[model samples]
Target: MGRGTAAGTVCFAVANQKGGVAKTTSSISLGVALSDLGYRVLLVDLDPQACMTFSLGLDPDQLERSVHDVLVGDAEAAEVVSATEDGPDLLPATIDLASAEALLLTRTGREYALRNALEDLLEQQAAAGTPYDFVILDCPPSLGVLTINGLTAAAEVIVPLQCETLSHRGVGQLLETIADVRKMTNRGLQVRGILPTMFDARTTHSRDVLDDVAMRYELPVLEPPIARSIRFAEAPAAGRSILRTARRTRGAQAYADHAKSLAGEREAAS
Candidate 1:
């Protein structure tokens, strides 16, 4: 992969195992923000509820195929992927994905199911000479089979953390889970960093919680905490990311900066 080149696809899982942390929002925003910088991006919605799908103006109920189909071996990933007006491609999700956990449990080598599927997808894309530059996995709010598949498939994991005491509750559990994944499935897996979301600089408590979290894990804290914004909640209703809906807002700028940092990291790694 060349420095800042779009040739190599970088897979990152945005996970927290805790709902309301802006996991889906971060995935979508970051994907689009990267696309804005001219990278071909793909966002995978691993949540059965399909918030990411619905956020992009795609109706999960009307979809004939989704990530669920791809995971269960019923459809190719290319068949389910759809282009979004926001510029990134999406492998959407639906309620059918709720059955994936039970289905994967019975199969041998189940943890590698997504890894195998994604590898085939990437190979097919590369053969055609139109590979994606970034693949962002939006994990559900639980560390189950689906989340494990993401952890297994990704080269790095970005944890979207809420700046609250209760929000930090799952950090330890997720780290322990990642430790297990590295030993058993993905040895190269690394935590990209913790992204503080839904932040409020007005309150000292938020700042304190952020400090406490950094000390707890000694993990890199991705900068420019996404400020608490109703614009985020409004964007989904408009079928767009904050980058599109509130382009001039601090939230949008934060995501754009985060994307730039990610690109710089890729170039440095290269």
Candidate 2:
């Protein structure tokens, strides 16, 4: 494969079965930030809400094809993948994706649906010789069939954890679910790292949560948690990454640094 079709790509699904954790934002920003460092990336929106798609400036309602269609065998993955100006390419989603869980029930080997759909994309990359350095799949905040597909396809997992007691409580259970997925589906899957988000350094509670989480997780916590930023909240409205819409903002720098550091870690590991 020579790092093309067989050497294997870093398919990290940014997942956490919890909402409001910056999972989608981290997925989108990390894709672009990594792309900025000269790596080809593909961000797959597995969430039926399609927040990642809409955030990147695409109208999920108007799309002719979505990740759901690809999962249900209605269309090819290449048909729905669109280019982004910065670095990552997007395989958008629409609300119709919600039906995918029921729609694919009758299909054989249903859990492997997304992995199957990625075949053409992988082959194309192999032939073009521009193999993607990373493919970030943004999973919904649930352990449903859609997330199952992502678990089946990915080589690693990147979880965005909110620095709050309630959110932190879910991590142990989430890791157990990952273990479940590994036992039956993706043994290759590993937790690349846990990224702490929305942290306030001034607050004792936030700092305590950060330390608690780091002490608990086996994987090293990526340094520099993403600070609470309204600019990050606003970037999606402008249909761009924080790196573009809020380039000079601290939120943008934090995410950018996170991505760069992740790449460096992977390089060193290899």
Candidate 3:
């Protein structure tokens, strides 16, 4: 692990309504890349699957605290945060998160639990002087409380879509949800950009999806899409990111490029 960069808060929700679009993969890898660039990143795992939690080698079952506790008001945000060797911090989720939906139905401010929790956390961090530069929320596949909480908490949303036709259908639905969140909860929110995942130039279908999405959403598209590569799949299994697993692979380089673009520190790579 290396030192981190000091910057202002720039929170983003890595989201998409469709599953298997590499949303979590983008969140985890981008967090690692941002950390490598010296920014202190906080990854909020809102997914019930806990893949992000386990990918970092944290056994959620054994941990005394999780994001569920923080969101449910049973624990403080500080208590649930855990530092990592990858230069970012993580708010791990647990199986109990699967029940958070039904449990939150009775709560008055169910949609704002995560937002309130983060505001409370920032208040404490601000007094300390070394505040976080970004908070990346890895939202669950569904647009439920978990996803809404992330949308409400984040300043921007990054939509990750696979280069496939079916993956294109949910963009409008997610954006509509984002619009609703902005109308009621967070007006400062905006769409960061759209990222195409598992993109393979060899496939004509990939090109069609990209063209269709560009003409439709009209959001800035991240070029040099993450190519389908074995390295990206292998990196997480070892609790490592592409920068470590296949640092030289095109897929790894693509993630780094995406991070640089997000931070406005570097232009998109060719």
Q: What count of clashes does model 3 give?
A: 3
TM-score of each: 0.96, 0.93, 0.92
- RMSD (Cα, Å) for all candidates, in order, is 2.1, 2.1, 4.2
Best by lDDT: 1
Q: On a 0 to 100 scale, what is the lDDT of residue 192 in model 1?
A: 83
lDDT of 3 by residue, 76-105 (tens): 999989987677899999998998888888
Error of 2 at 46 (Å): 0.6
* Per-residue lDDT over 155-238 for candidate 2, one digit per residue giving the tens place of the 0 to 100 score: 778888888886677788888889998999777678877788987877899878777787877656777788888898888888
Ranking by lDDT: 1, 2, 3
Question: Model 2: what TM-score?
Answer: 0.93
lDDT of every model, 2 decimals: 0.90, 0.84, 0.83
Considering summed lDDT, which 10 consecutive residues are worst modelled in model 1? 1-10
Candidates 1 and 3 compared by TM-score, better number: 1
> Which pairs, if any, clash in model 3?
4-38, 5-38, 5-39
